[model samples]
Target: MNVGLGLPVDDPAALLTWAKRADAGPFSTLGLLDRLVYDNPEPLVTLAALAGATSRIRLQTEVLIAPVHRTALLAKQTATLDRLSGGRFTLGIGVGGRADDFLATGLDVHTRGRRLDEQMSQLRRVWAGDAYGEGAGPIGPAPSRPGGPEVLFGGFAPAAIRRVARWGDGFLGAALPPRFMDRLFRDVEASWKEAGRPGRPRLVAQTNVVLGPDAVVEDARRNLARYYAFTGNAAHFVDGLLTTPGRIREAVTGFTEIGADEVMLYCWAGDPGQIDRLAAALHG
Candidate 1:
């Protein structure tokens, strides 16, 4: 299975260094998370910068908040970056769960799911040169690829999964419990077949990781609390994926065994040395 690393550096210089080093590492892609107002920079903006700095690593938005972005503008931005990076961008998008984010955007959080559906449809239209309106032909400049970056949909609901089969080129996010994963993957395949699509969509799942023989469960517990607070899936949110170095390796192989095309590791290692050590363990 293809393996990737989530880059979540708080410092810009350190982020750049890690992005560059990650490209040099064995990872297949560099996944970045998106939040409009946060410690980290906007994902697409950060990705544009990384595109200029790295040559080969495929860049991705692990989950871009669809409600906050202007659909057409985001399409253009992604296209420009994909062209800049020579067709190395994957747009993984979701209807975000953060109510505070919607409140900050002056939008009703309750409508985010519908907004995500609409925005995704609009993005496809803009990318395909469909008229933006009666007078506007389309947004430009066109991406180097015939279509813009491939869009992957992520979420853990039936509605979200249907959208993945309907609109997205791929499905993303982790699967919980081996049985649930089997069912979800099977359902997605059936959905694709039902759509009369030719083949199964790309599948990627992320496993949270913090590597060290000395790593404490408290570090994971603390991080899990923060994650659960953000995503609100407290039951499965924090507890399922967080693991020690040895457990992480086993889980990665387990995900691979379940037929995931790629497995993204959410590296929570606190420093550069830790990141290097973790990468070495996975890469080696």
Candidate 2:
């Protein structure tokens, strides 16, 4: 299995520094998280900068909340990003569970899941050079990839799992245990066959991490606590943090053993040096 690094979205300076460094070698992809009502930089805009900064590393939104954004605009933005990035873009999408995000964006929280299903189909038709609805004609700056950037669905809900077969190229698993991820991967494959998709869906697993001295590791724990505080179970996420080379290796191996095509380590420490620590840990 290949390994990927998740960029720390909270720090602007560290973003490019880490992206350029990771591009030199080590990680196969650079992932980012998204939240509309947060202090973190927007994933698409930040990744556009990374595209110019690095030539090789793949850039992806680990799970962009697709329902909040308008379909036509998203289609244009994603296609442009994919073209500018030389086809090194992957759109990992989900109908987020956070209500504040939807409420803040004037979306009906209850309708997002169904909306995302419609949006996914609309995105494909737009990317295929079909005249957009209302005779807007084909949106220019077509995606570098044939249909669009590869789409990977995230979430454990049945509808979300079914989306991988209906519209996505794969499943993007969240920070969950290997046993859970193994079952999710199997679920995605079974759903794919049930939907009559030609081949197995790509499976990618993600885990939060930071490998360094006690200070950096603690910084990560604190970050996770603040970010996931809304869950009221932030302690659970903090307790699962991967902080040592041995722990990182175990996490990677655990996911790989479960048939993950890629394991995405989300570094919360916000330190550029974490990339080196990750490379060493992966090699070790």
Candidate 3:
């Protein structure tokens, strides 16, 4: 299976370092997370910088909260990135659950799913050279590939899984066990078939990773605790991270066994050295 790495948004200075290392390493994609009320690098902006820095690695938004931004603007931004990256950009989008994120955007959290559905349709129109409105012209500079970047819908609910067939080119699953991921992947495939979609939806799964010395591993755990505190079960996530080479290999193998097209390893520790370690663990 194709393997990807998630950028450490906690360290902006280390982003380019991670980008260059991942581009030179065994990674198929360099991805980052998105959060409105948190201290995280904005995916598009950071990935744009990364696109200029790396010529090989594909850059992706592991899952950008779609309803948080305007559709036309989002389309223009993604198209520009795709052009700059030479068609190596993948748009992983979802309707986020965090209420604080919606509050910051002045949007009703409960309505985000509907808003994202509308945005998905709007994004296609905007990218297909359609006018923005009755008088507004089409957004400038289309994406490198037709239909803009391939969109991967991320979420676990039934509606979210259904989005894979309705609006997305694939399903971007969150960090979860093999059984959960397998069930969701099956659901995504079932939805695609039920919708009369041809071929299977691209299936990508994510998991937290941190492999290094005691200090580095501990740091990752601490950061994860705070990062997932909103979940009210931070310990479950913090303890579930793949902290060893054996765990990493097992996770990748499990995902591959489940028929995932790609597995994105999320780096909680903002250290470029993790790239080599990852390569050694997965490729050796």
Best by lDDT: 2
Cα TM-score per model? 0.90, 0.98, 0.98
Q: Candidate 1 vs candidate 3: which has greater lDDT?
A: 3
Model 1 poorest ten-residue lDDT run: 212-221
Return whichever of 1 and 2 wins on lDDT.
2
List model 1 lDDT by residue over 67-173, tens digit each: 88887788889989889999999999898877777778899989888988888777778877787777778898788777668888888888888888888888886
Per residue, candidate 2 scores C-alpha lDDT tens digits across 1-284 of: 78999887667777889999999977999999889888888889999999999999999998999999989999999999999999999999999888999989999999999999999989999899888888588886789999999999999899999999999999999879797788899999999999999978899999989988888888888889998999999999999888889988998899999899999999888888888878988887
Task: Please state the error at residue 141 of candidate 2 in Å.
Answer: 1.4
- Clashes in each model (backbone N, CA, C under 3 Å)? 0, 0, 0
lDDT of 2: 0.91
Q: After the best TM-score superposition of candidate 3, give how far the Cα of residue 246 lies from its true spot, in angstroms.
A: 0.8
Candidates in order have lDDT scores of: 0.76, 0.91, 0.90
RMSD of 3: 0.9
**What is the TM-score (0 to 1) of candidate 2?**
0.98
Pitting candidate 1 against candidate 3, the one with the higher TM-score is 3
Instruction: Give one digit per residue, the lDDT tens place, for model 3 in 221-246.
Output: 98899889999999999978898899
Residue 163, candidate 2: alpha-carbon lDDT: 94
The TM-score obtained by model 1 is 0.90
At residue 107, candidate 1 shows an lDDT of: 90
